[model samples]
Target: MPKFLIQATYTAEGTQGLLEEGASGRRAAVEQVVSGLGGTVEAMYFAFGEYDIVLIVDLPDASAMAAAGLAVKASGALHTRATPLLTLDEADEAARRQVRFRAPGAQGPAGA
Candidate 1:
């Protein structure tokens, strides 16, 4: 499973709903939504900054993440951003891959 870090900022109407429903209610709603998308909410937190909530979620793939993101954004209650997270082993593997590349103004291939 792939993991994602989601950051969300609630709108005034969203905050009003939260105040009425409470944190646990919100958590349950999130859990239900994620589960329906073939994912699980690993962790969630409320913060005081540019983003109001942060969540770590595990989903089967990028498409599932996209579906979840679109669903949330379509609600018009919150602004959400999702970033795919790579595990340490995945990062190491990516770093080991080799590729031929040239920066701007660099020399072309030997053939021209």
Candidate 2:
């Protein structure tokens, strides 16, 4: 499984609905949706400013993540951005891989 960070901002209509339903109500719905997709919500938080809510989630794979994200965006009440999270070991593994490339205007090998 892979983890994801979801940043969400509510629309005017979404804010109104949130007010009516309350935070707990929305949280329950969020949990249900995530769990239904074979995923788990590790943490959820509310904030002010650029984003209204943040969620840390672990899902089976990228396809499952895309399904969950697309479903939320389809609702039209809120907008979401999903970022894939990598563990430190994963980052190190990526860094260990190597390849070569030439910068723009740099010459290739001397052979004609």
Candidate with maximal TM-score: 1
Off by over 4 Å in 2: 102-112
Against the hidden true structure, what lDDT does model 2 obtain? 0.90
* Whole-model lDDT per candidate: 0.93, 0.90
Question: Each candidate: how many clashes?
Answer: 0, 0
TM-score of decoy 2: 0.89
State the displacement of the C-alpha of residue 59, model 1, in Å, after optimal TM-score superposition: 0.5
List clashing residue pairs in candidate 2: none
Clashing pairs in 1: none
Q: How accurate is candidate 1 locally (lDDT)?
A: 0.93
TM-score of each prediction: 0.91, 0.89
Candidate 1 Cα misplacement greater than 4 A, ranges: 108-112
